[model samples]
Target: MSQSATTTQNPRNPDRHQGLANGGTTFAGVLLAVTGLLSIFRGIMGIAKNDVFVATKDYVFRWDLTGWGWMHLILGLLVFLVGLALLKAAPAWARTAGVVLASLALIVNFLSLPWHPLWSLILVALYAFIIWALCTVKRGHT
Candidate 1:
């Protein structure tokens, strides 16, 4: 058989073919999805107890807790959508957006740590993982 015939007949290797050329992107996408869900849950909780939570320990800031809750809700929704897109083979821009959003989440959670210290810490850590996963793609492999 000619080289062209073999190349066209079996272009891909079933055993080696993965969803993404680099596994880091897939892992990062999964992390973003999970974290987005968590953010949605947390935002709902925040909105549910906006007043009491805000009143506790004089944690009131310039913006209302409910407003913050809304911000988180919107951000979470966007992140979840982007993550789904990433899983569905979105373009490189989507992946880059994920990284930027995750970084923003990290900063937001960090600044809000005083309100819910433990949960904020958890989110910060998760965001750190996301950033790491997104940034640590295999060099020269993709």
Candidate 2:
């Protein structure tokens, strides 16, 4: 009988830390922090001049630009905090929170698209990066 080779599993699986090991976490953290700063800037701009973000269509949902400013400001602050925590290797919860907040920011940006299409697109891309960074790591495996 021919013997089959047996593959041994890594008792101490380090793949979970691959993100951190390969500087993935650092890049993600820096990107997240930058995203937060950009959001804050956009929020301030929106607050300063509500009309700057003009509606593309009459039927589209329109919200008080000031209201969006507050929302973005709050979320930006939270995202910034989480980004800092990630840099410090705080915990998984921080990353998870970042993902959730990024997702929300994406939705908010989408609704606010009529205001500035370019910026909205940028936010969408950042949202995708945040989601990918957070979701790529296997929970328990990491």
Candidate 3:
């Protein structure tokens, strides 16, 4: 039988807290928190008229940067809260919420790609990883 069907353990690493034994949820939680914080900072910068973000002029989805900032701020706040909730890995609902929030993050990052290409793409990748991490874990495994 394959490994996943039988067990969630790494044969090479007996350290339960490190590998799939822990489902990488702990790492996901921490990364999500950091990503949220970064987004929050980016939001503040956009709201403050800081020229830190380079927005495209002739983009298809052009809008007031302030509005985008607000979206980022709200999304980041929710993501941060969900990340914190995932820390305990107690309530199953937290995982569900995390997955949902990660999906939203992906969309937000994709939409903001014209504003900041590299960072937005990076965040998209992070959100994808978060979604993968959240989805891979079996209930009660984390």
lDDT for each residue of candidate 3 in 28-52, tens digit (9 for 90 to 100): 7887788888878878888888476
The best candidate by lDDT is 3
Write model 2 residue lDDT over 31-117, tens digit each, in one string: 778888887887787788877667566737767888888878887877788888878876788778878887888898888777778
Q: What is the TM-score of each candidate against the true structure?
A: 0.72, 0.77, 0.81
Give one digit per residue, the lDDT tens place, for model 1 in 79-112.
8887887788787677788889999888878867
- Per-candidate Cα lDDT values, in order, are 0.74, 0.75, 0.80
In the predicted model 2, the residue pairs found to clash are: none
> Which stretches in model 3 have alpha-carbon errors above 4 Å?
1-21
Instruction: Output the TM-score of candidate 2.
Output: 0.77
Worst 10 residues of 1 by lDDT: 13-22
User: Which regions of candidate 2 deviate over 4 angstroms?
Assistant: 1-22, 57-59, 138-142
- Model 3 has an lDDT value of 0.80
The deviation in Å at residue 126 for candidate 3 is 0.9
